[model samples]
Target: MDYSLLSQAPLFKGLTADNIVTILSTVPHRVKKFQSGSMISQSGEPVNSLIVVISGVVKGEMVDYTGRVIKIEDIPAPGALAAAFMFGDRNRFPVNVIAVSDGELLLIEKPDFLKLLMRNDIILVNFMDMISNRSQFLSEKIKFLNFKTIKGKLAHYILQKAGKDKLSLKLDKTQNDLADFFGVARPSVARALREMEEEGYIEAKGKYIKLIDKKGLADLTIE
Candidate 1:
């Protein structure tokens, strides 16, 4: 186990070396590796344990009644708590957590985990902060989905991912994945991307998208 990486996790931030060693001694440690597109947790499944990502990315997505997929959030970094449903009253997961790349994870059973949290105030605060951040992110995503046009939603998404006015992104996702992320049909996303390309707002290659006119895309997000 990489204790250094574990120490860097927000949940363990500010923890002394001795404290981390103590926590590790108390908890049983195991590492599980997963491949891309593998489901870490499925919707409606029992939340028996808490999963911490040791490496790679994971995405939370949900499919609606009409079979339309909506991307809830993307976990781009490590130390992401993938099965947070266990923290609430409902034991079943609400969304599917899928691995976006080949990665490793650590799992701790819910019962023993709660015991650890009960004895540690720092761990409890860290867990609460993680949940609160996720809630805020979901709220923002809901607002993005309410946009009247596919173009508007896509524009908002691109700008949000870019994190800056001028940026480049390796869009490894297929058109279908983009459709799922934007909560629109495949054809709708394709058309919107084409329009953006034509308008010089973006440039798309096989698996790369370059932001050419970020201001134009950002403008679409404004009322």
Candidate 2:
């Protein structure tokens, strides 16, 4: 097993590789690999272990009643999955986790992981801090999802990510990514962008868009 991967995780941050190896020695752990598009964890499934991505990407998604799949967020390498639900009374995966690329994961059963937590206070505190951060992320996501229109969602996302009147080319996302995140169809996002640009709300170039009217965007976000 690669102890270095564990050392990179936030839950194990600040610990030496030797220290991580020592901690793992007390527990029975395993490494699992997933092919691209493989189901790593299913929604509503029992959460029995703390799974950490050793490498590659993972995506969290939820399907609504209408069968529309909403992409939650992407988890990159050295990240822990379902850490916040470990000690919950009804611990379960809230979203389906799928491998975006072939990846390796290290997992420790709850009982064994809890034992390590008991032995190491740093890990325990780090785990709590991670859960707190997850709560804040969920709150922001809820606020973003509350917007009914794709245009509103797009505006809110751009404003939050930009934080200035002008948005740069470094959006770090494609149209399809934006559509998946907004839980809307790809064409819907495409149309919204086209309309926003045509309406003089934003000036769109190949990779950058300048927010021509901050008030116009903000007013649209309220809906």
TM-score of each: 0.58, 0.70
Candidate that scores best on lDDT: 2
lDDT of 1 by residue, 1-223 (tens): 6666777778777787678878968986667998999998888888787777877888889999999998877775456655457767787878888999988887878877888889899988888888888788678768777887887887787777788644877665688977875677899888888998999989988667888888788787774
| Residue 131, candidate 1: alpha-carbon lDDT | 80
- Tens-place lDDT digits, model 2, residues 52-139: 9999899999999999998878999899888888777879998999999998998899888888889899998999889999898778
Full-model lDDT for every candidate: 0.79, 0.86
For model 2, what is the alpha-carbon lDDT of residue 203?
A: 77
On a 0 to 1 TM-score scale, where does candidate 1 land against the true structure?
0.58
Off by over 4 Å in 2: 27-45, 53-79, 95-105, 162-172
Candidate 1 residue spans exceeding 4 A from truth: 16-18, 82-84, 136-223
Model 2: per-residue Cα lDDT at residue 157: 80
